[model samples]
Target: MTVWQDDVARDLVRNVGDRLALLTRGEGSHVWDGDDKRHLDFLAGIAVNSLGHAHPVFVEAIAKQAATLAHVSNYFATPPQLALAARLKRLAGAGIDGRVYFSNSGAEANEAAFKLARLHGIGRNGVAARPRILALENGFHGRTIGSLALTAKKAMREPFEPMPAGVEHIPATIEALEAAIDDRVAAIVVEPIQGEAGVVELPEGYLAAARSLTLKHGALLIVDEIQTGAGRTGAWFGFNHEGITPDAITLAKGIGGGFPIGALVTFGVASSLFTPGSHGSTFGGNPLGTAVANAVLAEIEDAGLVENAARRGAQLREVIERIESPLITGVRGRGLLIGIVLSSPIANAVVAAAQERGLIVNAANPETIRIAPALTIGDAEIAEFETLFTAALADVQASLAASETEKATAP
Candidate 1:
């Protein structure tokens, strides 16, 4: 191990796995490791770096905001804070009655949403009238205790047993939703695309059916847009494709464009669910983060990155489909958030091989290689990716072929 790895092993917590590479600096769609080797960053910090690394707008905003006013706490809101809330409300189509709650990360945003669900559960007599909360079976919200309770991965939740009660998981299907939802459910949280679950899109009409069911049962329809928000999925928010407004939506990741910020945006009556003292964050809407995010979002709007994401995403899919690789089955996801489905469980090898070839991509699962590049990428980035990714696939295919040959000739 290198010095960084040695330090990490000696001092850091073991929950996180070993480090991949010691990335030192980044600019645009590329980053350099400790060895000064350049690698194309296709993951984009797991869809956080919307504007890419070391963007002038991001840096200028941060410097300007820090020189002016950084933090004044939640007691007194800053202009940037108010402006961002309004911007998010407008972009999310939350309407006139919409409200925004700021937090430092997506997990906190979802945690506040969890509290919102609990608030909605209270009856006229102040009893828990609606106690149930539903989430998709393989959905990932966050790692916080409150958010973790809503996540349905058994391996993740089993160790933290005796989790906050009243949370249930259902299949990601309209029929499953119809069977599971009822008046007793306070809310049903879902991702427009299960980013962590191999960029899986919900079945056709799933969101529309969910909207109808939740509306019929008087349950809040909460959309988790952490990974799919901020133009990552071709839309401003993933729910826009369905044209159905959610009761509330959690925002983070690309919203801050690599900065740490999260928000729970509520529409109509859901805005009033969180009363005073219900939820709060100290550095949630500080001027520094808000100003940077505002600048990042403004750049996205002015530069037409949203439209670019749509066009480039289609071009990328076409390019990947054209590559003749026996290991590749198909591609999934919308816009820049793509998943290359493999015929075998060789995702780890493929990722490693891509890294060796100076391209960065990750395995969403054993057979799914996720690719979420910066929204600013164009034809040049795409061309480079095609070459590197094709080479990576070839490397893995050759290794597999050699292994098969060795076994066939043995004995």
Candidate 2:
């Protein structure tokens, strides 16, 4: 291990494991490690870097905001904070009646949503009239206690048994939703695309069906847009594609463009669920983060990165399909959030190989390589990605063939 790895091993928590590379700096769609070797960052900090690394707008906004006003707590809101809330409301189609609650991360945003569900569960007599909450099987919310309760991964939740009660994990199908949802359900939280579950897409008409069911049962339909928001999925928010407005939506990741910020945006009557003291964060809507986020979002709007994500995503899918690697089965996902499905459980091997070839990607699962590049990427970045990813696939394919040959010879 290197000096940095040694220090991390000795000092840091074990939950995250060891660091992969000691990245020192980044600019645009590329980053350089400690060895000064450059890498094309296709993962974009797990879809957080919407404007890419060291973007001038991001930097300038941070500098300007810091120089002016950074934090004044939630007691008094700043211009950036109010402006961002209005911007988010408009973008989410929440209209004039919408409300925005800021948080520092996706987990916190979902935590607020959890509270919203609880608030909505209360009856006229202040009793828990609606006690059940539904989430899809294999869905990932966040690691926080409140958010973790809603996440359905058994392995992740088993250790933390005795979780906040009343959450049920149903299949990601319309039938399953129809079967599970009832008047007793306070809310049903869903993701447009299950980014952590191998960039999996929901069944056709799932959201629409969910909307109808939740509306019929008087349960809130909350959409988790952490990974799919901020133009990552060729839309301002993933739910926009369905044209059905959710009761509430949890957002983070790309919204802040690499900065740490999260928000729970509510539509119509759902906005009034959270009473004043129900939820808040100290640094959530601070001027620094919101200003930077505003600038990042403005840049995305002005530069037409949303359209670019759509066009480039299609081009990327075409490029991946054209590659004649036997290991590649197919590609899935929407816009820049793509999953390259492999025929075998060698996604990690492919990721390591890609790293060796100076490309950054992620293994969302054993058989799925997730790619979430910057929305700002254009023809040049896509071309470079095609070259690097193709080489990486070839390397993994060759390794697999060699392993098979060795086993055959030994037999």
Candidate 3:
């Protein structure tokens, strides 16, 4: 007899940890493991399942598209692709004057946008100076080489050094960003709320200041809305709340309602940045992906999910704040994207406790437990998680107290 670990499939990859094998079958605002145990999902597939699991509308759209037409090369255009592009422009308020390039993920979207920035930096008529991109510390763009170069996380960068040069990092601030912009810089890439960095919101006036500075420096402002777009942040795009129009915006995550799709949106001068042959993705505008994205956008509008996110986010924050656990230092994040800061670095412990109690959450950092629940989660679901989460924090506190008591009694 052979154990599960003895299987050839598990042997293919070097054993990193016993963690990755955890399998989940179905999820809603929650999910069930292969064991059929239910768990409240606060991560929302890291903010991908905007409509949650098994949404009938998305399923229907994907099924219909896959059956009729799933893919096509760049040489041909499909109706779903055209429709999604138009809808995204309307949602981003890019107007009919804008253009879009589709891709398969946020990183790919950013990669396409980055290349467009470089092209724009070089100018249309003459050879221009190589353009540099100014990204912020703790900012996350994507995993691709170019996007990774714009990303500021050292752990993700050190492994892939000598990344496309000309990318720079500055503190997430208007003044610091202003200081970083040189004549050779082409664009400043920013996330309205830094999701992976513990849901850090940009300082007030930061976007406005960036717009002014970029205008002064003749650079484009590229807002990476990968985690905050498509009603995730209670707005179509995070920049909408800031009242600033960026030169280019990259979007993914919930845009496809769990389908793999990403897009680069541009307006005015930025629209002309890329020529026909400058950039392309084979699977970028596939019928299946775009059709699902189109349905996702329509569902969001018809159901007013963005407004729901705003109202429910406040309610969730209030409920968590009422917990008032000494273990909980504070709660930060906007809309459905939330972060609970703990007094210690035992966030992973809290996450484990929550998971054991049928709740799924993520640790954004050692001390910050992040929750990005589905935008459509009901009031009852939020309350249930609040109770489970508060209790989990108590468990962490009790464990800490017991450990401290053991230390004191030992001496």
Candidate 4:
């Protein structure tokens, strides 16, 4: 007799040790557990499901591509790869006569950008010592060696050190930028909004300062848009909202809709930096993935999903603010990448409560709840979220109050 596969997976796999639910089905902004309980899916597979769960168009696109041509080696070119590259270039905007290096995850995208900065240094001053890369204090890149080095969360990185060196952190301040960035730097990488740091927005003038200072010191500016790209932030890219284009931008998460794909898009002088022998990825831009990505892009444009993201995001935020839940102190995000700040350090408890109430949400930090729903979610779904979320908050707060009373009366 064979044990169930789900039980085997739990015992065998090495993971981060936090498993919320075993989701078996998804449609629109909702998912179901193995027990057949339903959940409103605000997490959206950590911002990967662009069109929501099991959209007919997205399903057909994947199925058609898989039937036709699923994958091929990187040495060959596919029509979807070529077309997706062109689409990304055009959407990246006017000044960048750019090129793309596709990969399988956000970390790989940053790895490509990391190497680009080093190769750039070698090209500039043969066997050079300009070996510095600067990232932000709370920024989250990825789990790979190179990207982990760039990520600022020390606890995630301490076990892996001595990591790929020559990387440093800059405080999120204009003064820190003014002081730390100098000629010795090779490249400076940042997230336009630090997603892992509770969806924290970069203070005003910080990105513009990075752009200007990198220009002054001949350092490359690399932007990580992994969690914020592909209409997740309402605009085509977060940098577009901030009005600063970096030398290169890293992408993933929403680019392939629900599939796994990542890309490093470089602009102007940085476009041709990665020549032959500089980089490669076997599963990158495979036929099926790129075809799905192309379909996602078309759906975003043709259906005005980007505009929908803007409008719905505005509506969600407005309603949440108006609720004025005592537990909630403030709400912040652009487009659909929202973070709800709690009045206390109870985000993890809130996550559990929210799930119990049939809503899916996440704790970006101890005091912040993250919401990255599908771009295709409509008014009906948003209303459901508002109702469920309010119940969850009230439940948690009441539990906390009861706990305090019990403690007060305890001998």
Q: Which model scores highest in lDDT?
A: 1
Ranking by lDDT: 1, 2, 4, 3
When summed lDDT is taken over every stretch of 10 residues in candidate 1, the lowest stretch is 70-79
Candidate 2 structure quality by residue, lDDT tens digits, 1-411: 889999989988899855889999999999999999999999999999999999999999998999999889788979999999989998889999999999999999999999999999989999899999999998999999999999998888889888998999999998889888889999999999999999999988899999999999999999999999999989888898888999999999998998999999999999998887877788888989898888888898889988888889999999999998888999999999999999989999999999999999999999999999999898899899989999999999889899999999994
User: How high is each candidate's TM-score?
Assistant: 0.99, 0.99, 0.95, 0.96
The C-alpha stretches of model 4 lying farther than 4 A from their native spots are 1-10, 94-96, 123-125
TM-score for candidate 1, residues paired by index: 0.99
- Candidate 1 local distance difference test against the native: 0.94
Question: For residues 1-411, could you state the per-residue lDDT of candidate 3 as single tens digits?
Answer: 235545635665753334522445655686787567888888888999899888888889988988999888989989999999999998898876799989999999999878877886785566667468788999999989999998999988998798997788899877798778877888888999999999999999999899988888888899999999989888888898879988889999999889999999998788987777888888889889999999988998999999999999999989988996898889898899999989989989999889888888998999999999888898889989988998898888888999999999995
What is the C-alpha lDDT profile of model 4 across 222-242, one tens digit per residue?
989999999988999988887
Tell me the tens digit of each residue's lDDT in model 1 across 1-411. Answer: 889999999999899788899999999999999999999999999999999999999999998999999889788979999899999999999999999999999999999999999999889899899999999989999999999999988889889888999999999988889988889999999999998899999997889999999999999999999999999989899998899999999999998999999999999999998888888988998899998888898899889999889999999999999999999999999999999999989999999999999999999999999999999999999999999999999999999999999999999
lDDT of 1 at 176: 88
State the number of backbone clashes in model 4. 0
* Native-to-model Cα distance after best TM-score fit, residue 58 in candidate 2, in Å: 0.2
Off by over 4 Å in 1: none
Query: In model 2, which range of ten residues has the least summed lDDT?
Result: 273-282
How does residue 329 of candidate 1 score in lDDT?
Answer: 99
Candidate 2 residue runs with Cα over 4 Å from true position: none
Which of the two candidates, 2 or 4, achieves a greater TM-score against the reference? 2
